[model samples]
Target: MGAWVTRALRNFNVENRAERELSKMKPLSAPRHPSTKSLLQEQMSRHPEIEGEIARKDDKLLSLLRDVYVNSKDPVSLKVKDAGVLQESKEFRLPIGHHFEMMNIKSIPKGKISIVEALTLLNNHKLYPETWTAKKIAEEYQLELKDVNSLLKYFVTYEVKVFPAKDKKALQPK
Candidate 1:
């Protein structure tokens, strides 16, 4: 009876030791890759051309973002007026003032004037009708008359929309 009891105690001790060893065992894990920033830095250092490639890729991404933002925020339909393509309308409609959204204008130092500048010139002189002419805008902005005319034409076609009505006469205050 003593021998049997001693054997049972030994077995119990072994089982507890085994359980403790199992509990302390760590899981097998795969090796982890380097962080993204570190990997990119390593690649850039290894291959110098990668820097330029990255810059070009960033530029392309920036241009794509600009196009998306500009087109989505301020949508405009292109119209070829010189080709005589017009929307079907039986009556003329008055142009709504101050309805168009302001466009993003990029400033260029000592470069050709953009449509935004021309529009700004026209917008600045709202009180005077004489300054609204293309000639005046061209002279003020030091741009060619043709350039100013083209910008004005583009503004009228894109920014201003014509609403059609059944009556041709002007609206009278009732």
Candidate 2:
């Protein structure tokens, strides 16, 4: 029994030692090729005339770019004085007031409502569904009736619930 136990432990130690050595060994990397920058330098050295041609093309390109920059500096007028007057209509006006004065007044795209308006509409629909129906909300916010119906059906405000502890002793602070 002693001989058998010693032989088993010796085999286990040899196997463990081999595994430890294998784990410590690093993987070998593949051979590398010459870098692109070095290859480009060698090619440029062989063609001396190509260097002169490149310089000439670069100078021509710089001149063209300078001409464009000078021309762009002169502001092109949109002739706002000659343009047609903007029609004042309810359709053009925003349903909500602006937080700040806008420089340019542009009409909002059709079938869109602000985040604040959407929340208010949802809250109203939730509290007073009969008064603030999908039809009323659609007319008030200038949204499609189908879209308003979908919003009310799918979206909901956060609902919080609190549960009391089963044991009165557990509620007491340590």
Candidate 3:
């Protein structure tokens, strides 16, 4: 056992020394690519006409921008008189009574029912379990049968249980 322990320690130290030597060595450098500046210089030297074309386009753009700036400086060129006038010109009032009626007429999307509809469904299912089974409810509401089964299995309406007072005297009307 003593010889085995010494041999294990010596092996561990030798492995650690190898690792340390590897860590001390410098990493190999990555291959270099020419810089963007040098590449651009080479490209410009190859195509001198490109430089003249770019200058001409830049001058045209500058003149157009100057014209736009001058036109923007004259308020009459812009259709909007005052900022407030622009806001006042458009009507933002929402349609009231009739819009709600139209919305109610819209069909409910599949797999979804309104809160009132959900409550009604739950109440009906509870009151008439046989008549409003999960299959029937799912068909009527356009919901998945599994969802209806889960809903029926887990959820319940508010049940108010009235517990009598602990003492009989407390129950008597004052």
Candidate 4:
């Protein structure tokens, strides 16, 4: 019995040592993908307006991508207020696919958090913070306002209380 326990402890130590050694090595990125700097440059070229927006919000967008997106297994979304104007801008259109060799991404992936999920994340008080607005979530995640509005309306109809009663009723289903 004592030999078995000793062997188990030795195995655990070996595993821990292997993990530490692996941690010391540089992390591997997605295969066939451009480096972080190049990817940001490509994204900037695709969305010219986005050039200063990310930097203005979080200095040096590269760090944001590396620290937030690259390391994350799941998608990362932002929730800045007043993002509709940016999305509605003419610069945010689909890229011209006629003359591109490795830039097939027409639209960025936006993370979706259900109304129930959002509500669960927020305080139950009637006076929810302004940051919890659907518009803010849509902006942060680069989602369409119409889609977000429709989702909010649908959830509200189902009697989910993410927003104030008056606000919920006021939200157009379009």
Candidate 5:
């Protein structure tokens, strides 16, 4: 992992565990077509308005889920208050993609998340914090809105080819 990503993982207590699992996971297959190259793009194409949202709420959600699985030291007993699957599962929760999908976001791929994309999403999407429409993003993702807004922002920050609606040129100040 790159230095910055390693630093970013510091935000999660399960860095070691996630890293271990990630290391064991298979590498992503190359995209055959450029248009189909990015998951972020597919996500954005699904929910174009998601572009303007910030990453704070998504950070909060990550904190909460991490608290349950990592910080709390109860990876197995992590129970999400309103989550049906968490409620049903009697085992500690692992940082799996299921929850992210439920929330309409996803982790950047094993080697893809980087500083450049991070800046784009943070600077641009962060500008539209409360205005982000999760439902809209979710519709594009064909998934729930649990953490989609923030994830999309991250994807956008990384320049994942997520389509954007062309904004009208600003009116002249003259």
Candidate 6:
């Protein structure tokens, strides 16, 4: 009986140790790729000429963001004008002030998006207008007009529809 009990205890200990070892060996969830540094390295490798371009673009973007946050009036306020809201409307119906979701603007993937590209998308897409002209928008939101203008221009030039309806006289051919 003593021999049998000792053997059973030894077996149990071995089984538990094996289980712990296997647990440690179990595959971990695929590790997320470290994207940022790798992307910079890839860019430098494949397109060395673009390093300067990347830096310039980054400067402009940073400046614009800074201006919008620093110089605008409301800085953090969010609002919409009725006509402007129409700019983001689709032929189908959308809630009065929820159009910005059309282009997934909040999550634009990191890449070289031109102003025309952004404007075309935001204008033609089902965006909910959250900003007026930069000056007005800046005043209301406390963002700098330069930054807001850059962002707005990107949307305005490409997606003319995203712009608020021009007043009748303003619409007259200049």
**In candidate 1, which residue ranges exceed 4 Å CA deviation?**
1-111, 114-116, 125-127, 157-174
Weakest 10 consecutive residues of candidate 6 by summed lDDT: 90-99
Choose the strongest candidate by lDDT: 3
Q: Compared with the true structure, what per-residue lDDT tens digits does model 3 show for residues 51-119? A: 888657576878888888433365664566576687666534222223346464444456777666778
Tell me the tens digit of each residue's lDDT in model 1 across 12-68: 879789989999969776655666768877887899997677556576778888887
Q: Over the stretch 1-174, how does candidate 6's per-residue lDDT look in tens digits? A: 999999898888787898889879667667557877687687689988886775565667788887774544753334556556765562332222345556545422222333434454345333545444446544543446686666665544422344555676555433
Task: Give the candidate order by descending TM-score.
Answer: 3, 2, 1, 4, 6, 5
Model 2: residues >4 Å from true position, as ranges? 1-110, 169-174
Count clashes in each candidate, considering only residues at least 3 apart in sequence or on different chains: 0, 0, 0, 1, 10, 21
Task: Give candidate 4 misplaced runs (Cα > 4 Å).
Answer: 1-108, 111-129, 157-174
For each candidate, the alpha-carbon lDDT, in order, equals 0.59, 0.73, 0.74, 0.56, 0.53, 0.54
Q: Candidate 6: how large is its RMSD?
A: 27.1
Whose TM-score is greatest here? 3
What's the C-alpha lDDT at position 30 in model 2? Answer: 62
RMSD of 2: 19.5
Question: lDDT per residue, candidate 2, 1-174, as tens digits?
Answer: 999999898888797899899999697766446677687678789988877876575768788888884335533345443353332323543645453244343455458876656777888888999999999989877889999989999998875666667897776543
> Estimated TM-score per prediction?
0.24, 0.37, 0.40, 0.21, 0.16, 0.17
The ten-residue window of minimal lDDT in model 2 covers: 81-90
